[model samples]
Target: MNTPKVAEHIVNWLKEYATNAKVNGFVVGISGGIDSAVTSTLCAKTGLPTLCVELPIHQAKNQVSRANEHIKQLKNRFDNVSEAEVNLTSTFENFKTVVPSFESTAKLDLALANTRARLRMTTLYYFAGLHGLLVAGTGNKVEDFGVGFFTKYGDGGVDLSPIADLVKSEVYELATYLEVPTSIQKAQPTDGLFGDSRTDEDQIGASYDELEWAMQMKDAGKTVEDFSGRDLEVYKIYTRLNRINQHKMVPIPICKIPNNLK
Candidate 1:
C-alpha cells in the first residue's frame, strides 16, 4: 500500500466526516495498541481537536506507560492533540461489589473483562459529549471483521472507525509513518481488559498474521478441506470465531412486525 497516500486519505476522510457531522473533532480511547495509536494520530492530522482519553481499570504498568508515551509524543507533534486520564479501578470494584458473586470461572472472567471495555466505552462517550467530539473507534479489519475479537457495545460501540479497513500489518505501517512512540509500536497487542499479561495471540490462539491469512482464505471461498496440521488448526480457529461472533459483525436483530397485524 502507498503508506503516505493512505494516511492522507484517512486524515482527509476523518476531517470531512467530522465537519459533515458538525462535531468539533474526534475523541479516541488510547489503549497503547497499534490500532489506537494509528487512529488517534490520523485524527490529529486533521488539524481538529483530538482528545485522547485513557481509561485504565487495574491496567498493567507497561500498557499505562505506553499510553502515556504515545500521548506525549502526539502532543509534541500536533498542537490540536489533548489528553485525559480517568482511572476507573474504584468504579469497577464498586460495580463488582453490587453484582452477585459467582465462583471464578472462565465465563466469569470473560464477563468481567467485557465489563472493563464497556466502562471504557462509557467514559469515552462521556468525554465526547462534554467536548462535542465524536467517539473514534480503534478496531482493525482482522480483529473487527475477521475474528470479532472485540466486546460488543463496548469497544465495538463508536461514532466512527477510521482504521477498520486496514489489517494489523497496515496499522503498524501507519504507526511507523505517524512516528508513534517506539514503546507502543513494539508492545504486544492486548486488550488490557483482563488486567494481566495475556496477549491477544494468547487469547485468540492465533497471531494476527495467521488470522489475516485465514481471513483471506475465507474470503476466497476456501474450506476446511484446504489444509492439514497447524494450518488446519488455525483455519478451524478462524472459522469457528467467525461463525460464533457473527452477531458482532452484523447489525442488531430487530423483529419485523407483519403489516397485516399492524
Candidate 2:
C-alpha cells in the first residue's frame, strides 16, 4: 500500500527471517538501479548492518556512479551502510584464458552474460560470509519466479529475497514511497553486463510490465490461450527458463542407497 507500511512489513519480515536463520545482518549488490535501491532501503529500515557492493567491469562508469549514489542514499536511511567495489575484468579474462575455446565474445548470449551474473554473486557471497550476513537477493517476483531472469547458481542462489513478492512496477512504487532518489528510480533496468549492447529487458525480449502481466495470469493457473500475443511470448520465455534452470534451483542430489542392503 503506502510507503512506510510497505517498508515496515519488509523490515519485519527480514528480521524474522534473520532470527529464524540465526543471521546477524543482510547483504545485497546495489546495481545503481531502483530494485537495489529499494532493497537497500528495506535492509536499512530493518536496522541491520546492510552491506552494499558495487561490482563494475570496464566501461561501466554510469552504473558505478549510480551505485555510489545508491550507497549515499542508504547512508541517510541506515546506520551500518558500507560499500566495496571489485573490478571483474581481470577475473573474467582469466576465466576465459583458462577454459580452452571459451570465447568471451560468444554468439550464445547466455554464455557471456551469465559470466557476469555469476561473478557478482561470488562477490556478494564473499562479503556475506565474511560479515556473517545473509545474501539478500535483489530480484523481484517477476524476475525470479516469473521469467526466471536470473542466473542459475548466480543471482538465483540467495539466502532470501526481501522483494520476491513485489514485481518491477510494485518495486518502483515502494521506491517512491521510500523517497529513493529520482535518478535511481527512473533509471533503465540493466544487468550492466555489456554496458551498451546488453540489457536485462533487451535479453528478456520484453519489459517488466509485460512480464508481470504474463506472470499474474500464469500464477492464477490460467490457460495459455487466455493470454495476449506479447504476454504469450513472455510466458514462453518464463517456461523455458524454468525448465532449463531447474537444476540450479534445486538442492544437490545424492546417490540413493538400497534400504534393504543397508
Candidate 3:
C-alpha cells in the first residue's frame, strides 16, 4: 500500500469530517501505542484544535514518559495541538472501594481491567463535552474486529475511528510514514490497563502478526485446520479467541418482532 498517500487521505478525511460535524475539534486519548500515536498524528494533521489527553491511572513510568514525549512532538509539529494530563489513580482507587465486587474470583481481574478502560472512556467524553470535540478512537482492525480485544464502551467508545480499517501491522506502517517517535513505534504494544506489565499478546494468546494472519484466513472462509503453519497451537488459539470475542465485534442484538405479527 502507498503508506504516505493513505496517511494523507486519512488526514484530509478527518479534517473534512470534523468540519462537517460542526464540532470544535478532536479529543484523543494517547496510550503511547502505535495506534494512538498514529491516530493522534492524523488528528494533528488536520490543523484544527486537537486536545491529547493523557489519563494515567497508576500508569507505568515508561508509558507516561512516552505519552509525554508524544505530546511534545505533536505540539512541536502542530500549532493547534494541545494537551492535558488527568491522573485517575485516586479516582480509580475510590471507585474500587465503593463499587460492589463480584464474588467469583475468576472474573475480578478482568472486571477491574475493564473498569480502568471505562474510566478512561469517561474522562475522554468529559473533555469532549467540555470542549465540543469528538473522541477519536485508537483501536485497529485486528484488535477491534478479529479478537474484539478492546473493552466495550471503553476504548471501544468513540465518536469516530480513524484506524479501525487498518490491521496492527498496517498501523505500524502508517506510524512510520507519519514519523511517529521511534521509541513509541518500536515499543511493545500494551493497553496500559492492568496493574502489572502485560503485553496485549500475553493476554490475547497470540502475537498480532499471527492474529492478523488468522483473521485473513477466517475472512477467506477458512478454518484453523486450513492454516499451513506448523504451529497448530497458534491457529487454535486464534480461532478460539475469534469465536469467543465475536460478541464484542458486532452490534448489540435487540429483540425484534416479525412484521406479520403486526
Candidate 4:
C-alpha cells in the first residue's frame, strides 16, 4: 500500500541522509498546520534530534497551544526534541517603520504575510546552523508543487521536504496514520496571518477537494471538454498560481559557463 511504503521510505531517507550528511539533527517550524505537523513527525521518526519552533505573530493563544501539542508529540517520540517560541510583533512593527507607505498600501498585507513566513525560516536556519541540523520543509505537493502556496525565500527555502509529493488530503491521511492529535486533525488550516482574516483555501478560491479532483482528472488523462463557469474559474486560478509562482519553485538564475570547443 502507498501508506506503508511511503512511511518506510521517509524513515529510511531521513536516517540515511542524516548519517551520510554527518548532521546531528533537524529543525522544523510547527505552524500548528497539518503540513508542518506531518513533517515534524516524519523527521522525529528517524531517531535524530529535532527542534520545533512556534513562530506566531497575530494568532490567538490557542495557536501556540496547538503548536506546543505538536511539539510535545514530537518530543514524546524523539528524546532530543525541544521547543522554542519567537514573537515577531516587534520586528514586524520595526519593519513597518521603514516603509511608511506600507501602512496604507495593499503591499503591507503581502509584506506582512511574507515577513511572518521568512521570520520562521530564519529562526529554523539559525538552529540548523548552530546545531548542525537540516531544515525540514513542511510543504505538500498540492501546496508546494501544484499551487505553490509558499512564499519565496521563506517557507519555500529548506534543506529537505519529506512530503513534497503528497497532496493536501493525502497529508491528512498520513497524519491520521501517524496519530497526530485530534485537535490538530480537525483544526482549520490557515497561514495565521492578519488575525486569521483569511485561509489558504479562502485566497485560492477553491477547496483542496476541488483541487485534488482536478489534479486527478489531469493525471488520469482526462479533461473537461465542457467546463462550467465555476470550473473555468477554478482552472484560471490554478493556472495563474502556477505561472506567477514559478520563480518561487525554481532555483535562482546563475551565470552560464559556456564551453566553446573548436
Candidate 5:
C-alpha cells in the first residue's frame, strides 16, 4: 500500500465526514498504542479540533507514559490538537464497591477489565458531546473484523472508525508515516483494560501478523484442512475467534414482525 496515499485518504475521509456531519472535529481515547496514536494523528491532520483524552483506571505506568508521550507529540505538531487527563481509579473503585462482589475468577476479572474500557468510552463520548466532536475509533481490520478482539460497546463504541479497514501491519505503516512517538510505535499492543501488562498477543494466543495471514487465508476460503504444524495452530486459533466473535463483526439483529401478524 502507498502509505502516504492511504494516510491522505483517511485524513480527507475524516475531514469530509466531520464536515458533513456538522461536527466540530474528533475526540479519541489515547491508549499509548500504535492504533490510537495513528488514529489521533489522522484526525489532527484534518486541521480541526482533535481532543486526545487519557482515561486511566489503574493503568500500567508504561502504558500511561506512552499515552502521555504520544499526546505531547501530537500537541506539539498540530495546532488544533488538545489533551485531557481523567484519572478514573477512584471512579472505578467506587463502581466496584456498588456492584456485588464475586470470588476472584477469570470471568470476574475479564468483566472488570471491560468495565475499564467502557469507562474510557464514556469519557471520550463526554468530551465529544461537550465539544461537538465525533468519537474517533482506533480499531484496525484484524481486531474489528478478523478476530473481533474489542469490547462490544466499550472500546468498540465510536462515532466513526478511521482505520477499521486497515490491517494491523497496514496500521503500523501509517504510524510510521504519521511520525507517531517511537515509544508507542514499538510498544506491544494492549487494550490497557486489565491494568496489567499483558499484551494483545497473550490474550489472543496469536500475533497480529499471524492473525493477518489467517484473515487473508480465510478471506480466500481456506480451511483448517489446508495447513499443518504452527500454521495449523494459528489457523485454528484465528478461525475459532472469528467464529465466536462474529457478533461483534455484524450488526445487531432485530426480530422483524410478519406483515400478516401485524
Candidate 6:
C-alpha cells in the first residue's frame, strides 16, 4: 500500500506533531515486537531524540535479545536514537508479594499480568517526564480497536499513537518496508505481559488475520453468515471479544442530564 509513502507521511506527522506540541522528543517502550519496532523506527526517523527503553519484567530471553538488536540497529541507522534497559523482574515480584492472595488463581494471574503493563507504562512516563519527551505508543488498529486487546491506562496510555490507524497486516507491510530486523519481523506477536511465552493469538482465541477480516466486515455492516464462509464460530468469537472489550477503545462514558432538566 505504497509503504514508503505511508512511512514518509507518518514520519512527517510525528515531526510536525512534536514540534507543534513543543515536546523535546519521544520515548518508546520497545517490546521487540513488530509494532514496537516499526513505531520506534518511525519516531527515530523524525530526527528528534528518541529514547527506546526496554523494560523487561521477567521477559523471555529471546525477546530481550531482539529488543537489544533492534535498538542497536536503530542507533546505527539514526543519530538521534538511543537505548535504555530497565529490568523490572525483581520489582514485579516484590509487588506481587504484597498483594493479598485470591481464591481465584485465574483472576489473580490476569491481574498480575496487567500489572506488568502498568509498570512499563509508569516507567515510560518517568523517562518521558525526565527528558521532556512524549511517550509514543506502539499499538496498531487491530489490537487497539478491533479486539481491544490492550490494557487501559497501561499500554493504551500514551502521548501519541503513531500507528493506531494501521491494521496488523498493514503494520507488517510497513515493518518490511522499514527494513526491520528479519528475526523481529518473523517473530510471533505477544503482549510480553504473561511472563510465559504464549503468543497473542493463543490468548486472543483468534488469529490477527481472522480478526482483521471480521473487523472489516463488521465495519462494512456485514453479517456473520455473509462472510463466515465455513466457520461461523470465528465470527461469533470475534464479535464477543469486540463487544466485551469495546470499553477499552472509547472514552469513559458519563451520565448526562437533559437541558430541560437543567
Query: How do the predictions measure up, each by TM-score?
Result: 0.99, 0.87, 0.95, 0.91, 0.99, 0.95
The 10-residue segment of model 5 with minimum total lDDT is 189-198
RMSD of each: 0.6, 2.5, 1.7, 2.3, 0.7, 1.6
lDDT for residue 147 in candidate 2, whole number 0-100: 63
**Candidate that scores best on lDDT:** 1
Per-residue lDDT value at 119 in model 2: 85
Candidate 5 runs further than 4 Å off: none
Q: Model 1, 1-262: lDDT tens per residue?
A: 9999999999999999999999999999998888889999999999999999999999898888888989998999999999999999999999999999999999999999999999999999999999999999999999899999999999999999999999999999998998988888888899998888999999999999999999999999999899999899999999999999999999989999999999
In candidate 5, what are the lDDT values of residues 1-262, reduced to their tens digit?
9999999999999999999999999999988899999999999999999999999888898998999999988888999999999999999999999999999999999999988888888898899889999999999999999999999899899999999999999999999888998888889998888877789999999999999999999999998899999999999999999999999989999999999999
Task: List per-prediction Cα lDDT, in the order shown.
Answer: 0.94, 0.79, 0.90, 0.80, 0.93, 0.91
Clashes of 1: 0
Candidates 2 and 4, the one with greater TM-score: 4
lDDT of 6 by residue, 1-262 (tens): 8899999999999999999999988999999899999999999999999999999998999999999999999999999998888888999999977888667687788898889999999999999999999999999998888888999989999999999999999999999999999999999999988878899989988888988888887888877767545346667777888899989987899999999999
Name the TM-score of candidate 5.
Answer: 0.99
The residue-level lDDT of candidate 2 at 149 comes to 71
Local accuracy of candidate 4 as per-residue lDDT tens digits, 103-175: 4566767777788788778888988999999999888887887778888878988998889888888889889
Q: Which has the higher lDDT value, candidate number 2 or candidate number 5? A: 5
Q: Report how far residue 122 has shifted in candidate 2, in Å.
A: 2.0
Please, what are the lDDT tens digits per residue for candidate 3 over residues 89-180?
A: 99999998898866757388888889999999999999999999999999998888888899999999999999999999899999988989
Clashing pairs in 5: none
Distance from true location, Cα of 82 in model 3, Å:
0.4
Local accuracy of candidate 2 as per-residue lDDT tens digits, 1-262: 5767777889999988888888889888878888888888888777878888887766467777888887987786668887787888788878766766744554644676678789889889998889899998888887776666777767777888889888888899998888888888878888776657466787778788877776776678876677667667787776676677566555778999999979
